[model samples]
Target: MSLTQEQKDAFKAIFIETVTNFAQQVGQATEKVFLQILPLTVVAGTEYLKSYEEDLKTKLEDCKTKSQKIIGALSTVKEPEKVEKTGDKHLPLGELLGKRVQRGEDWKWDDQDGGIGSFGKVVGVKGNGWVKVQWESSRNENRYRWGVDKAYDVKVVEIVDDLGDIPPLEEQIKKPTSWVIGKSVVRGRDWKWKDQDGGEGQIGEVIDVCDEGWVEVKWKNGTVCQYRWGGENAFDLKVVPKPKE
Candidate 1:
């Protein structure tokens, strides 16, 4: 009699559990045997376990061959699509939108270089091969063209999957409005300044609040510096309750 869908699912679960337990038991037994065999091989000399070793090696090879065949029959996995590292020729313009990118070695314009390791986000796509990018370091917008000297100069570092949650390029860099003195604040979730001052979760007092979105904070670890909190920069701080005075 053919099994119902529910019965089939129950059987599959039981089969998986049984196989998992069997694998664990086999692994434990094999480990114990290996431990015993190691001492025996050392104390009794290599020749003592030579015959059994050869037999085990033959069995292992047989198991590997059978496993390969089983895997080939069951698995429909194909080799992953290889990306060419030679140039950005493989990168399409459609894939680059809302992506954070860095300049590659092939970038020729020395005067327009956005520092060595600075990264930027693609905000707009221009005609020809040019793309508009909002740079993190400069907090300025710049346009870069692709396929310079046969190879594209842009190297994508990150892709912003959900564009709906993010604001426009112009809105992101504008000066923040909300800033008051003596407020307790912590670094935002997307805070990138891990090496500078105290890292994430380090609470500090907002010593000086600026209209330009930068706030001067005195960290608990005696670090006093200005950081971007809101507006044109990434929201770098979140207000927390004042400590029990």
Candidate 2:
């Protein structure tokens, strides 16, 4: 079967064209299949991711609910009752009522001086965590009240069976007396001037004694002002006995 050179060339050209056409047809078919499956693949992947996200969301919600339940349980659980230590013994808050307490025994509130070293008997206990104390210095109608925590924390008061007896209201509070004008006096303890010029231990003269326990004083620095005698000023004035002329 020997063929001429021209015939051999024609056969080679036809074989090359047929192979190229077959490769082009195969490539087009593969491209068509990929285009048809791409949308479905994307949709399936999206659905899978959505399901995973929803599962994670559900888990997070469950965790949150469980945390809330745990917190609620902790909040509802009653705390163990604590026994407060006083001196050598431990006592509860209920036993503190009717106890005798002294002022300045321990730190209470900043403004409260623990009754200023005076004794007090617990008269009543309030549900709002306050104990009513009848101070020895206070009148019958007047009572000092303190928080339950402070009453327990401060070693000022102790449980006492006997408080002796309460004095009459009239005896507790002294009667008002007239102040002699031009009387020399020294500023008492914790005395502060309104203008902050003079203070405790400063010398002054009583110019007048007004109603409502207010006393007008002319200080050595020539500052004249009125102050509440036994109130916030707490001015303890010691009268200087006038020397014989």
Best by lDDT: 1
Candidate 1 local Cα displacement, residue 127, angstroms: 4.0
Residue-level lDDT of model 2, residues 1-245, one tens digit each, is 89999999999897556656755777755455556556876999999999999999999999999999999976774423455454622234345554666543334454343345666555444443444454556422123334433434233456543223323333322422122234455654455544443765556655555445565667768887775555453544545543334
Itemize residue pairs with steric clashes in candidate 1: 172-232, 173-232, 174-232
Lowest-sum lDDT 10-residue window in model 2: 171-180
Q: Write the per-residue lDDT of candidate 1 for residues 1-245, one digit (tens) a residue.
A: 99999999998887556656755777765455556555764877767688789999999999999999999965754323334566443465545655677886567656354688887666555334566666767656667765432445667776534432434434433423222234566766457777565676777865544446676777889988777766464676665656655
Which candidate leads the pack in TM-score? Answer: 1
How does model 2 score by TM-score?
Answer: 0.26
lDDT for position 220 in model 1: 84
lDDT of every model, 2 decimals: 0.61, 0.52
Per-model TM against the reference: 0.31, 0.26
